[model samples]
Target: MVEKVDLLIKNGYVVTMDKEGRLFKNGAVAVSGNRIVAVDKTSSIEQKYSAERVIDATGKIVMPGIVVSHCHTHGQASMGMPAEVEMENFYDELAKWWWPFLEDQLKKEDVYALAKYAITEIAKNGVTTVDDVMEAPKDLPGVLDAEGKAFLEVGMRGILAFEATERISKENGKLGIQENVNFIKKWNDKPDALLRGVMCVHTVFSCSPEMLKEVKELADKYNAWINLHVEESMYEVEYSKKHFGKLPFEHLRDIGFLGPNVLAAQCVNTSDKEIKILKEYDVKVSHNIQTNMVIGVGLAPVPKMIDEGITVSLGNDGFYLDMFETIRTVYITHKGVLKDQSVLPPKKVLEMATIDGARAVGLENDIGSLEVGKKADIIVVDLNEPVPLNNSNIYGNIVSFGMGKNVKYTIIDGKIVVENQKVLTVDEEKVRKEAYDATVRIWTRNGFL
Candidate 1:
């Protein structure tokens, strides 16, 4: 009475970072179309289900593919732009570099090209899902439209949010919110869509209370999520304290903006009280450990937050496309900062990259762990390389020494997006050339090269 498997991956060491954290040696996973129907010993699976296609993952580790909790992949072509010379203050970094780049220099062709390139890049690194928090122009720019189009073209599963702001004026905030509403309406009912809609209020500092409520209402009406940056730096905490007589999270709690649907990125400056508030509101945190270290911001209290029942997930924070590097950074940085090797165990960090990240994006039941009735978003890593295959500490090797180069395959929703380190959905070379050329042009146009 056994059903046939559409695909079977045999002879791999499977690390199912499920709630129970199970591991199976010499295991096989039988996939019935998009869902993993069975995970058992290799001998048992071979006896039960016949496979149309078989992947010999011998001497490899099979696990859930990574989900990047927050990424601005639309900025792939803006990689090398100079840090603003006059950006002494936090707000100035936005005005001089990020906002101007979005408003003045980017073209539609560039957004399309950049998105195409970013999708392939992340997939090659074994990342199957990403939350692209795109900051579109104040007016609906051609490039912003193309960014969405490119995401659709690349066939990457994601949630797209138009970064909304009231910084220019109250009218501009309403316009930004409307843009989000329009995009959400366009794709709300599409079945089998890899993309979902989100309303991104840029940050608490940039949006007015009315605009925040409007965004919340729009997201609720569409049953979509709201993504935003919160407590990213020291000044953000001070600004909230000065303006509202409370910390940043306290301000959000008072205004009723903290909710399960709200994804708050980068709580690097959050206090213990703020962590408690986050746990109460069920707010998810996208911990960008590398970006914080690079930007000289203090480390996030991730272990404390995790202990407080706040769901902390890993994010790249626009630093690199490789999720492996991000995972390594989180594991090492938290341990170093806390002065305890036992702070963030490898198993916990692995969960952050997989299941916890899916929970942050509210897709836990659909595609996090490799379980029955869940979408087969899986990656195959070659363990015969520098990654030692010793069974004594295979889990530690994966988090510490595993690199993106070791990833041999990436599958999303039962479809092979990357095989043998090559992207199947698009021309990799063409996209890379376009991204590089566009970066040069955008930089020259802005006089920042």
Candidate 2:
């Protein structure tokens, strides 16, 4: 008897980023009801399973969907604007430009519109799962809800949060916390929802110790993942020492806030002792390579972190949504900084983008790699390489030559979200127009227009 499946993808080179690193030249994946039923050689899958829909992935590379451990869905509006500013460092840019722009000019409509636009771009870039931090304290009441709506409309999977910070005011901080809590309670029980809520503390400098403790307690109560920035700049470390009388990681550890569920971004200035503490607590790190490079923050000690058995994953950090560029940046950044060509091999970088990233976001068993019974989050990349794409050259081609524009299909939760490089769930042009209008409004409000 033949088994029936909802979809069958065949005739591709499948890179199953599993524990054993399995690869099949002529491969196929069978999906049934949002779960992968089987992954095997194309002939075997074709003979055993009959499907209602089939995607002939000829001359394509099929792999697990890219996972972004940290991103800012609301920062899409500020993408190109930061580049034009001549600033000394990240702190200067944040204080003189970015923070003022966000706190004063960002509106509710801007959040919603930018989210739709961001998710659309992310889907096109082959990112299926994202951990998004929404930071617009001025637009708090339903800001997260609006972003959630955008994610649902775009048919992408996301773990969303409102970055609660006490720097603005006690009332504003309370509102931010309430926003995250309310969104979590509202969506946590929903059946088969694609977007869920996570807890976010902006940073140690912005969030008081009390606020951090309270957020940690809330995460513990709800059993949720906590995403936050940690030691992203020298200023943050200096501030932590000045205020808390200890390093940021030390203070966090002393407060009992470090844990396996915490996803800390940046860590560019972490010390050896701090790295040890991170390893001891098993906290995950989200490496935003492009953002760090663009902002001139020092490179993260990823090679050392990996050696210590720390879980480090790739993230865009709202700099750009393209995971392909992120992967390449991570690959070459470490190599160039360390002056060693052997660091960060292509295969390892790919793993960071996919499997390691899923683990960072606490979705390892569900959506990381192409495994049976895992959620069907997959992408098809058209290599379009001049040289032959075989087992040995596949990773090199992906890292060096591939771009997000080469993504032909993005599938999330057994649904085709992007087909032929176009988003299917939302109106692309309308989203783009609204995003542009919102950007203009925000720029005008900030006097940048």
Candidate 3:
């Protein structure tokens, strides 16, 4: 008997970022409900299954939807203000601009509006999943819920968290914890939930040891995922050593906080020993290439980490929503830094953006690849340019020439969230206008205007 499926995407070059790295020309993917049922040659899929809806992907590149491991949902509206701060270094930017804006000016509506706006852009850019850290302690009671509402309205998958920190005050930190724990309890087990909550302790410098231990206990109690920054700057390491008499990762490990469920962002300043510790504990890493360079922090030893069998995933870190740009940046940045063109090949970089990212978020079996039984999170890239997109040159073309704008379709959970480069879940223009108005209000209140 012929099988019935919900959707069939046919006649494209499919890059299955699977365990064996399979790529099939004239390919097709069949979906049923929210799961992919089959991925094979177009002729085979056509003969075996009839779909309710079929997408003719002629002259396109069919691939798994991109995964973003780290970003701040709160920064979408207030992105450019950091450039206006006139900071000489990372510490200056954080202390003078970033913290003050979050503490004083951020509001509940701003969080909701900007999160919807950012998720709209992310969907259009073919990113199906995002690991987002939400701040704005002053508006903590319902801030994560506001962001969660935005995520639901935008129809994107997200692992959300409130960044718990002691930099502002212990009371504020307690509120942050409350926000995250409440959100996690509210959404972590909701059926068919596209947005789930995780635990976030902002960074080692901003979190006391007691706070870290409490966060860990909360995460363990709820069996939640943990996301945080680890040694993103020299100042963080210095602060940890001066205060705790150990490095940041060392202290985290000692406190029993580092684990397989923890996703550490920007190990830019990790020493060799620290990297070993990360490996020893099986903690994942999120590499934000553009943000690190923009902040003038040193480059992370990604290639070395990968060699050490540590899983390093790619993230834009709210610097940009375009994962294609991030993929290209990861491809070339390491080559330029190492002066070896052979380092970090296109396939490996693409893997970091897809499957490795899924692994980082503990969802590898669900959404990372174009395989049977995985979530139908996929994208169709328009490859109608003059250059031919074939098996031999597919990876190079995708890394070197692909842009987020080239994505013609973004399918999440077997549903078309973005078609023809436009988001289907929300009013794009309304979201943009609200984001701009919120930014103006925030900037004016923060004295930036």
Q: Give the winner by lDDT: 1 or 3.
A: 3
Candidate 2 segments exceeding 4 Å error: 82-89
lDDT tens digits, residues 304-342, model 3? 999899999988877698889999999999999899999
| Candidate 1: residue pairs that collide | none
TM-score of candidate 1 against the unseen true structure:
0.94
lDDT of 1 by residue, 352-372 (tens): 999999999988988889887
Local distance difference test scores for all models: 0.81, 0.89, 0.89
**lDDT of model number 3:** 0.89
> Could you tell me the lDDT of residue 215 within candidate 1?
81
**What's the lDDT of the predicted structure labeled candidate 2?**
0.89
Residue runs of model 3 more than 4 Å from their true location after superposition: 82-88
Candidate 3: C-alpha RMSD after superposition: 1.4
Higher TM-score: candidate 2 or 3? 3
TM-score against truth, every candidate: 0.94, 0.97, 0.97
